[model samples]
Every structure is written in structure tokens, then in C-alpha cells.
Target: MEEQPLISYQHVNVSLQGQEILSDVNLELRKGEFVYLIGKVGSGKSTLLKTIYGEVEIDAGEAWVLGNAMRTLKRKDFPTLRRKLGIVFQDFQLLTDRTVHENLKFVLKATGWKNRTEIERRIEEVLQQVGMENKGYKMPNELSGGEQQRIVIARAILNKPEIILADEPTGNLDVETGRRIVELLQDICRQGSAILMTTHNLNLLSEYSGKVYKCEHHRLTETTNS
Candidate 1:
């Protein structure tokens, strides 16, 4: 039996301002997979991730994420599709003025999770998942760089997304701390959500074993240890 893909892109070509960014891109991510995306700056790593989550429009070809077709998705449909995806940026992107709890609450409300009890429960659940249940009341600025990132991860999982698209998630952390953060993301993948992370950290790729997809020369190539 063929396994279902959580993410699929077929013959995808992405362009910005009339210049092609990604070309002939075809990829698939199944549930519970931890895939590495490696490329130098100006490469299509970010562009590919954005295309998966519908942030970048494909100039040609197709992208399907958890059954939501990208080419045909309407603006109004983005919120619902986005709910199934958790995105962690290189920058923590936390709301500085709001407490960690409020930061999550804002997304919940925006996504139509209205029941107060359910929202609170889900918030606690994700916080606990990221090992920061006690820091919910603290301001984003008060937390360490890594802790803020953890909260960002927590918020990403609030909706139980089928896939997590993380772009340069550990870019701002120290080497040791970055490994810890990568391990946390690995743990999340073990729990059944596919994770596609873009990183320049060759050490992470070398130290932590997983399938890798390299975005380079305007194409994506899957690697295997022969």
C-alpha cells in the first residue's frame, strides 16, 4: 500500500518579479518524517517552504498540502489551510508586549478557536509539549532566545498541524543550544507530524541522522546513504 503524503509538490516553478526562483521542483513528505532542507542564501529553500504553505504563489505546476491544493486556494481559504500547518521563523516572532499565553491566545482567536476552556486546555497542552508550561505568564522578552523559540514551537502546534515548516529555526541560537532545539523538533516529528526544516547548520545534518533534501542549482535532490 502506498503511504499518504502530508505534502506534495509537482513540477513546481516559483518566480518573483519575473525571475525564476525554483524550477522543476517535485517533492513529497510523508507523516512522521524529519527532513532537512539545506542550501546557501539566495537559494530556493525559503521559496520552496513558502510555496508549500501558500505564502508564495507557484508560477507553474502544483502544490498540495494535506489535501489543500495551492494553485486554487482562495485568500479566505488560507486561514483554514494554515491551521493545518505550523510555521516557525528564524526570528522568534513572538509578541513582545504580550505574555506567552496571550501570544498563543491571539492565534487561537484568529483561527476561530472560540471556546475559552478548550483554548486554555490546548494552550497548556502545547506549552507542556515544548517543556515550558510554567513560563506561560512571562513576557517574550523575558525568556531566553531558546525559550522564546520553544514558545513559538508551542504556538505552532496548538492546532495539531499535520506538517511544520520551519525556516532557519536555529539560526539565532548558539551551537549547543541549537542542537537542543533541533532535538526538540526531532521529538515532535516522532510524534507523527512531518517536519521540513531549512538550515545552514551542516553540523546538525552531520550529527543528527535523517533524510535530507537539498535545494540547490534550482532543484531539490533527495539524498540517501548508499
Candidate 2:
């Protein structure tokens, strides 16, 4: 039997401020799979992610994410839905006032983690996974763009979320740094978390391997790697 998709969107449509952003969108992501959404800015890449996480409402069609119905999700249930998924952003949104360890700890506490020992262990594990094990004492501004992104990934995985939704995660880095970030995300994906990332750098498409989808002319179309 085939594995069920962690996220699915069929004939979905979305609009913002009376402008149709996406139409008849269809996509699926399974466990341990890495998928990319490549498109120009304002092509609804972010909008799609928003819909998955319930930040944006779908105008039409059916959608499901982690068992939650996107077309009819409730406001009070937002936390319940978000807790099952991780999100990575293009800009590192780390707390400028805290150390790396503190930032991770804050998320844990907010998410209801109470045991100090367990929180420390989980944070250490994620830091090591992202190759930031030795920099947990530093503040966000102290790290380079790539390092900051690594820290963000570490935070995203602290709860062991089943799916990771990344928006332009490599958009702010240099070529080599961006490649490294993608590689790290791929490694995480291999370890079992499905990832759907949006990117403008088609250069990544030629190198890294994954299911590629393009958002253009108000449609999402999967493209083969060339």
C-alpha cells in the first residue's frame, strides 16, 4: 500500500486583496520527501505555504495538512495544527536578545516542554544536526547569514515536526552558503521530515535533487530536473 501524503491540495484556489494569486493548485508531499516550489516573487509560493499552515484561507477546493482540513480550519485550532509542523523563513527570525540555547529553550517552553534536562538534550541534538553544536552560546547577530539560517533550522526541528515548510530559506545567502543550507535541509529530510521549500534560485534546481514544482501564470506545475 502507498503511504498517505502528509499534505495534499487539490483544485485549491487563493486570492489576496481581490487579486487572484493561485488557481486550481494541486500538490502532495509524503514522509521523508523533499519538494521545491520555484517561481518568481509574487507568484503565490508564500501564499501556498500560508494556506498549508492556515495563515491564509483557501478560496475554493479541498486541502489537508497533517489531518487538519485547510478549507475549514478553525482559529482556536491553529496552535494544534501548527504544533505538528515546522516552518523556516528566508530571514532568520531569531530573537536578537537571547543566546542560541535560550532561543531554542524559549520555543520549547512556549510549546509546553517543562523538563529542563529534556529541553537541553533536544536543543543539543538539533544543534548538532545543523552543525551548530558549538555556537549555542552566541547571539543571532554574532552569526553569519548561513549560520543564522542553521540556527533557524535547529529551532524548527526542536519539536520533531513531521513536515517542514520553508519559504525562500536560501534567498539571502551567498552561492556556496545557500548550497550548504539546502544540503542541510536535505539531510534533515532524509532523516524523516518531509520538506516543502520555495526558492527563486533556479540554480539550485540544476544541482540538488528533489521533486520540483513551479508557480507561474497562476498555476503550480511539477517539472523534471534537467
Candidate 3:
């Protein structure tokens, strides 16, 4: 039997303020798949991901995320849908005042993970997954750019999200660090989480082959080669 796509958007159109930013956008991401989202500035890369995560409203088509219809979502319905999604950012949005453990704990609590023991275990598991097990107690300022980004990734996975929607996740890191971070996200996909990352790092994309989706001139295009 054919399996359902992890994320599906059909004939989707998104508008901001009063301008149509994206039109006729169609996409399908399956379980464990890794896809790259690329385009120049204002080409709708962020808008596309925002639509998937309910950050933006689509005025004209169907968008389904883990089977929930995005076009009809309510404000209160965000948490239910967001629980299945993990979003990573390039700036490594860590709380400068909190320790890694505390940062993870905060997210766990917000996501309804209340058991102290389970929270600790899940935190450890995700940190280990990101190769930052030894840095859990360190404050955000104590870590390097790559380590901080790893912690951001760990925070995203605390709820065991089915897919990660990353926005320019490696944009601020060095080339080598960017490659490492990308590899780490790819590894996450192997464990069953689909990844949709938006990046302008074409060099990394050239080396990291997978499905490619580009936002350009208000359109989404799929690349079959490279």
C-alpha cells in the first residue's frame, strides 16, 4: 500500500499583508525523507515553511501537515499541530541566561512533558543524538556556534517531532560547521524524522544530495538532478 506523505501542500497560495508572496505551491514530503528548500531572498522559501507550520496563512489551497488541514486551523489548534513539528533556526535561538538542561526542560514543560525522570531522559537522549551529551549543563554563551546550534536542534527534538522544518539553520556558521550541522540533521531523518531545510548554501547542497525544492519567482520547483 502507498503511504501518506508526511507533509502535503496542493495548489497552495500564501499572502502577506496584502501581497501574494507564493502561488501555486505544491509539495509532498514522505517519512524519513530529507529535502532542501532553496531560493533567493523574497522568493518565498520562508513563506513555504511557514505555511507548513501554520506561521503563515494560505488563502487559496490545501495544506496538510501530519494529516491536519492547515487552511482551516484555529489559534488554539496550533499546539496540537505544532507538537508534531520541530523548527531549527540559523541564529541558534538559545536563551542566553539558561543552561542547556534548563532550555530543554523549558520546552519539555511547555509541550506537556511533566515527569521529571522522563524529561531528563529525553533531554539526555536528544543531546546524545546531537553529540552534545557533555555540554548539557553549560550556558548558551559557553558553547561555540556549532555546539549552540546542536543544542537548538536538541531542543527541537525534545517532543519527538515527526518532521523538522529548519530555516537557514546553518546560515551563520562556518562552512565546515555548516556541513556538520547538515549532517546531523540528515542523521535525524534516518531515525524517522523528515527534514525540510531552507538554505542559501548551495555548496553544502551540492555535496549533500537529496530531494531539492526551490522557491523562485513566486513558484516552487523540484530538481531531479543535483
TM-scores of the models, in the order given:
0.95, 0.98, 0.97
Best by TM-score: 2
Q: Alpha-carbon error at 64 in model 1, in Å?
A: 1.3
Top of the candidates by lDDT = 2
Q: Please give the RMSD to the true structure for each candidate, in Å.
A: 1.4, 0.8, 1.0
Better of 2 and 3 by lDDT: 2
lDDT of 3 by residue, 84-194 (tens): 899998788788898999999999998898789999999999999999999988999999999999999999888888999999999889999999999999889999899
Least well predicted 10-residue stretch by lDDT in candidate 1? 217-226
Candidate 2, residues 162-196, lDDT tens digits: the string is: 99999999999999999999999999999999999
For all candidates in order, the CA lDDT equals 0.89, 0.93, 0.90
Candidate 3 regions with alpha-carbon error over 4 angstroms: none
Model 1 agreement with the true structure over 1-226: per-residue lDDT tens digits: 9876888888989999898888988899999998888889889999889888778898888788888888998988987788889999989888898999999999999989889999999999999999999999999989999998999999888888889989999999999889988999999999988999999988898788778888888988887622
Clashing pairs in 3: none
Candidate 1 regions off by >4 Å?
none
For candidate 2, the TM-score is 0.98
